[model samples]
Target: MKINGEVTTGLGKAAYFLSQEFYSLEFERNLGFVPFPGTLNVVVSDDYLDEINEIKNNCQNLIKPDEGFGAVKYIPAKLCDEINGAIVFPAKTTHEENYLEFIAENKLRDQMNLKDGDIVSLEF
Candidate 1:
């Protein structure tokens, strides 16, 4: 499946969330890589809202957080057809439903040369 989106800025907490041992370890187990200590925030196309909801509906597992930590879910994804990653949804996230947070083994912003407003695509 494919979803179109535009890169966007986040609340600047991806590094903190990604660095937590609980999230890092769970991400490695689920996505096959310990993601770079950050995420690529994307504002998905409005047309893909249903698809995004479907993914959330089908999510059977949760990345349960340790005490005092927030929760998240992992959804497998491929970014720009090259980087392997997972879309993460934090339980305490401030983003809207159409906003997705992607975590990969590499620094996606640098690797893809992405900046705010850059269009991107994701495959699941």
Candidate 2:
């Protein structure tokens, strides 16, 4: 499956959670790499809401967080048909339904030269 969306800025909160030792260890164990200390936020159009929900419902790769943190589920995905990454869905998030969070081994924005409003594709 594939989904496309425009790059957007996040609430600047993901880095703290992502940088935690417990989460980093879990990511390394499950995904083979510790994610970059942040996430790439993508805002998909309403047209894909159903598909997004479907993906979230079917996702099986779950990362259980330590105390005081929420769990997250992810599915391996490719960013812009090139970079390796995953689409992560947090069990608790302030984001709306249309927002998608992506994590990779490196900073995706820098690696892809992406800026807010840039359109990108994710292939699973």
Candidate 3:
């Protein structure tokens, strides 16, 4: 499956959470690379809302977090047909249905030269 969306800014909280040892260790073990301490926010186009919801509901590869944090489900994905990443669904996220969070080994914004409103494609 593939989806395209415009990049958006997030609340700037993921870095702190992602940097925690528990989560980073799990990500390294499961994803083969430790995620860059941040996420790339993509607001899915309205046309793909239903498909995004379907993936959210059906995703089973979960990363259980430590106490005080929430579990997250993730689907392995590729960004722009090049970067290896994952589409993450945090159980306690404040985001709406159209929002998709991506994590990769490198800081994607710099690596991809991304900014708000830039179009990015993810393939699962």
Candidate 4:
């Protein structure tokens, strides 16, 4: 499946959650590597929001909270053709359903040289 969106800024809080050892380990185990300490926020285009919702509905193998932390759902994704990543939906997120976060082994924004308002493509 493929999804397209515009790059956007986040609340700068992903590091607090993603940097936790519990979550990092779980992410590493699930995704085959420890993700960078942050996520890349993508605001779904209106034309593709419904498609993203459908993918979320059918996606399986979500990562659950260890104990105290919030839960998160994930769908495997690749960004910009070369960046291996995943679309992450946090149970306790500040973002709306139209917004999704991408987590990867490397810093996607830096690696891809993206900025807010830039167009991004995701292959899931």
All candidates: TM-score: 0.93, 0.96, 0.95, 0.91
Q: Give the winner by lDDT.
A: 2
The C-alpha stretches of model 2 lying farther than 4 A from their native spots are none
Runs with alpha carbons beyond 4 Å of true place in candidate 3? none
Ranking by lDDT: 2, 3, 1, 4
For candidate 3, which ten residues in a row score worst on lDDT?
51-60
Residue range 1-124, candidate 1, lDDT tens digits: 8877999988888898789998888888877899999889999877888878888878876898899888787788899898888888788877898899988999888888999999999888
- Angstrom error of the Cα, residue 107, model 2: value is 0.9
Q: Whose lDDT is higher: candidate 3's or candidate 4's?
A: 3
- Put down candidate 2 lDDT per residue, 37-105, tens digits, no spaces: 999999988999888898899888898888999999998889998888888999999999999999999
In model 1, residue pairs whose N, Cα or C atoms come closer than 3 Å (at least 3 residues apart or on different chains), thus clashing, are none
lDDT of 4 by residue, 1-124 (tens): 7778889999999988899898889888988989899999998867777887787877785777877788888988998788887889787887888888999998887887899999988898
Q: Judged by TM-score relative to the true structure, which candidate is superior, 3 or 4? A: 3
lDDT of 2 at 20: 97
lDDT tens readout by residue for model 3, 5-121 = 899999988999899998888888889889999999999878888887887788878999889999989889999999998988889889888888999999999998999999999
Where does model 1 exceed 4 Å of error? Answer: none
Q: Quickly count the clashes in candidate 2.
A: 0
